[model samples]
Target chain A: MSDAEDVMIVLDESECWVLLRSHSLGRLAASAAGVIDIFPLNYYADGSTILMRTTPGTKLVEMTIHSDVAFEIDDFTDEEAVSVVVKGTAEWLDTRSAIEEADRAPLVSWLPTLKYVYVRITPTSVTGRRFVRGPEPERD
Target chain B: MSDAEDVMIVLDESECWVLLRSHSLGRLAASAAGVIDIFPLNYYADGSTILMRTTPGTKLVEMTIHSDVAFEIDDFTDEEAVSVVVKGTAEWLDTRSAIEEADRAPLVSWLPTLKYVYVRITPTSVTGRRFVRGPEPERD
Candidate 1:
């Protein structure tokens, strides 16, 4: 709307991945019964895949029904803002070996509930954008 | 996890609404062809409804196909965190009066792209959680 809002620049793929690895928290989008749902969860970025754990609930149910989902992470201060979105497919880590590896991941739940079920999202597309404020005019 | 993570408490419905009205930015989730998508957008809270504007894109197309969507807002610092989630139905304000009123809403796009189409989400469920750090014990 204003000149300040025109400073958003598209981020390259490398930039997107960097931002993803930098943030620990993000929102995961999944659909259940034709209704979309989002949950704010902590994630571990392992290579190109995003790893997270959740208990039995709507998130797990929707991921099981439909693996195609979106994951997003964003951060902003008074001066700058960055947002990254990953479109990917989710899979439950049911094997003993996979579960063992996930337990060693840096991702830790902030909630008191046990998040034992590990879900992995291998992204097909990664995109992001960054917004920065323009410099102010110099004073006389 | 540790005892520190156990400090997350579920906020009541009123607290959730209060937090929603306090924040301007949130993520909107919509599903298309069984694939879920999310977008970070700014919004205005009008009573029990969430109002936002967007250009014609995947988000608008998906909301048209299925109105059921989810909106989420959150804020956190090093010591505290708060998150609120709303599950609701999305509808385009096609009527002249609805469009006229929504144009005056406090919500404004931060991107250069034109966001003329106003959409309203009437939340059916609102939930939230707040994480606060417990007081540290005195050193021996």
Candidate 2:
């Protein structure tokens, strides 16, 4: 069990996610040096949601097996940036509708080699923050 | 719950981790947005063992809140890069002996602004991958 204080941190509005940061292409990155072969991916906005596509041997197929996964998307430069995380359940959508949506993403042109493998991240919990980097001068 | 048929990728003798290519410097590069907010961090070394430290406001702290977390770290350039991810049931280190071992990590000098908080990370399930964005193709 976690302490009440820790729970509060988990609930922090700055950076607590349910899925991961692979929802969009703002600054998408992922890795799994430890467990479950984590994939932290990101793509650009197309319409109401984010989209991602990988080749046949890619791990995106496995990510679709579970409905509950973590998704995170963020963009930061210097001091200010947006970090959005979504912890939710995902349902595999191999239907024609999902594939069409994946092909329409802006990032599709950016990386044209990938195939369609769309996984919608439904945010169970969403939180984020903004950092000012340097503190304002304190009154002396 | 994950299915047993999860497309598992085997690591060769030379491939220790599945890393991503990042340019953000140290661990910041592998983050979703190169920001300090919003992290689904997972810390894992091997099975049943935790690969994290006890630090305040760090990735491990957030993971140990009884909530499973995902961790990704990376380094990158135009041609080559590496990233790693970990997901698990984050645990904490409240004892002195555990803290001693964690403090001996080689990368501890990267950050200097951690205190008051101890260590924690949920390294229950693990995953990772590597990418080489160069001309010819690189091995993983």
- Largest TM-score belongs to which candidate? 1
- Candidate 1 residue spans exceeding 4 A from truth: A1-6, A56-66, A113-115, A133-140, B1-6, B61-66, B112-115, B132-140
> Which residue segments of model 2 deviate by more than 4 Å?
A1-37, A57-59, A75-82, A109-115, A133-140, B1-70, B76-81, B87-90, B100-115, B120-128, B134-140
Q: lDDT of all the models against the reference?
A: 0.78, 0.41
**Model 1 interface DockQ:** 0.32
> Model 1: how far is B40 from its true place, Å?
0.1
What is the CAPRI rating of model 1's predicted complex?
acceptable
Return the clash pairs for model 1, or none: none
Per model, the share of native interface contacts recovered reads 0.39, 0.06
C-alpha displacement of A90 in model 1, angstroms? 1.0
Alpha-carbon TM-score of each model against the true structure? 0.84, 0.53
Candidate 1, residues A10-41, lDDT tens digits: the string is 99999998898988999998876676678888
